[model samples]
Target: MSKSCQGLFVEFVKCLRESDCMKASVEHRSVTECAKVSEECAGLRYTFFRCKHGQIDPRTRIKGNKGY
Candidate 1:
């Protein structure tokens, strides 16, 4: 991915953290997989990912924010 896209993902994760929207027991998954599954899981946005080799990547967005 390009640097700008990576930066966006990081920022999105940071926003989730700042808003307390991420889950505690979430396991890291690929960005592609996360994008696919996020819609199915309530309140679970793509926070980050780790590849088979343990490389870390992150993606983020708000979920289950019914009050706001």
Candidate 2:
């Protein structure tokens, strides 16, 4: 991951650890059922995704990364 996206990545990981998704994963006792579709983390995930994609996209590169 790029340095610009690291902050968002850290935030996303923190959100995931605190979210019910982690609880569900614990309950199931398997990684296969782990779901990152939680409502709270959705926007963070989207922002992180956009930031990462922007790094490689020329058009977005011109517009600049909207690092959050």
Candidate 3:
């Protein structure tokens, strides 16, 4: 069986919701703050990849940076 997270549909759905909320609220924070938080979250890259629930979210990225 694939260890990929694509199987966890519910988790993918929840990630979508949180991404939306984060995107919507992003404008409320300063660029510096966004960068700080984004870095903090990115630090959890290993956990995100191991999620086996959902992949990393673009909206969870910095406000104006392209994703890797």
Candidate 4:
């Protein structure tokens, strides 16, 4: 990847690690809503991304299907 892309990847990983405390709340919300509240793909963005893409696991606390 390009230097900028690599930097972003590193930042993303750091951000996710830093946000490991926020658990996903189960609810029902559209991708539009998730995008509205997401901290720019950092903390809960990954959870919402999984929800939007239908890849979230229902068994976890982050049942991301909700308005996370």
Say which candidate scores most in TM-score: 2
lDDT winner among the candidates?
2
Of 1 and 3, which scores higher on lDDT? 3
Ranking by lDDT: 2, 4, 3, 1
Cα deviation at 52, candidate 3, in Å, is 7.9
Candidate 1 residue lDDT tens string, 1-68 = 53424554565455444432244325655444544544443233432322211223222222211111
Question: Can you write out model 3's per-residue Cα lDDT over 5-66, one digit (the tens) per residue?
Answer: 33443443344444433567746865335434553344343343554323344553334222
- In terms of lDDT, model 2 sits at 0.76
lDDT of 2 by residue, 1-68 (tens): 67889999899878877777677665554322332557778888888888899999999788778776
Question: Model 4: per-residue lDDT, tens digit, 1-68?
Answer: 32323444465555544432333525654444544554755444554345445433456435433432
Give me the displacement of residue 50 in model 1, in angstroms.
Answer: 22
* Candidate 4 global TM-score: 0.30
lDDT of 4: 0.45
How far does residue 18 in candidate 4 sit from its true spot (Å)? 1.0
Please give the CA lDDT of all the candidate structures: 0.37, 0.76, 0.42, 0.45
